[model samples]
Target: MMLASSCRRFYADGSLAPWGVLLAILDIWALVNIFGKPWDLSKKLIWAAIVFFFPFGGLILYYLFGRNSS
Candidate 1:
């Protein structure tokens, strides 16, 4: 009961759990890589949108395909 309440409190304020933090870090990494590349503006914007909207899958797609393309 108490543990459940504590967890609810912890998650109530939009705070991230451990996996969420990891996903955020990966998203940041993908964003940085997307910006740092010499791709054109439209391409960067598209990738940024993908990373922003779909954090985990976007990051994976970027790392697997986009990174080597740049």
Candidate 2:
């Protein structure tokens, strides 16, 4: 009952949540950049998996280390 009420508030007026939308956009951007690099197939797959599994932390780690790695 409490969970349902909170969910309704989150999706009030059929509008999406702001932070959720921003996070999704950021994640997609990370995925695109991840696949665009000329990285080895195995490495690419590993990064992609990390982003998929841990979207927020993955973006941070990718920008910090993965982007500069060749």
Candidate 3:
């Protein structure tokens, strides 16, 4: 009974909260855009690493600076 209650609460809390979902969407967008950029393989890899590790901050930085804008 206790285990079932805990599981119910876990789902009730929404496993991926609103911000988590937003961040996931942003990360996916960033990754796709990163690959579409004109940067070389190494730079694209570096940006991918940053986005993978940093998520929110990396997406902001990439859109603000790293993105080629072309």
Q: Specify the highest-lDDT model's number.
A: 2
Task: Please report how far candidate 2 places residue 40 from its true position, in Å.
Answer: 0.9
> Residue-wise lDDT of candidate 3 within 8-57, one digit each (tens)?
32345556455566667778888998998888899999999888777767
Q: Which pairs, if any, clash in model 1? A: none
For candidate 3, the TM-score is: 0.73
Q: Which window of 10 residues has the lowest lDDT sum in candidate 1?
A: 1-10
- lDDT score of residue 36 within candidate 1: 92
Off by over 4 Å in 2: 1-15
- TM per candidate: 0.76, 0.75, 0.73
Q: What would the per-residue lDDT of candidate 2 be over residues 1-70, giving only the tens digit for each residue?
A: 2112223324656765666566667878888998999988899999988777776677789989998899
lDDT of each: 0.72, 0.74, 0.71
Off by over 4 Å in 1: 1-14
Total clashes for model 1: 0
- Off by more than 4 A, model 3: 1-14
* Clashing pairs counted in every model: 0, 0, 0
Clashes of 2: 0
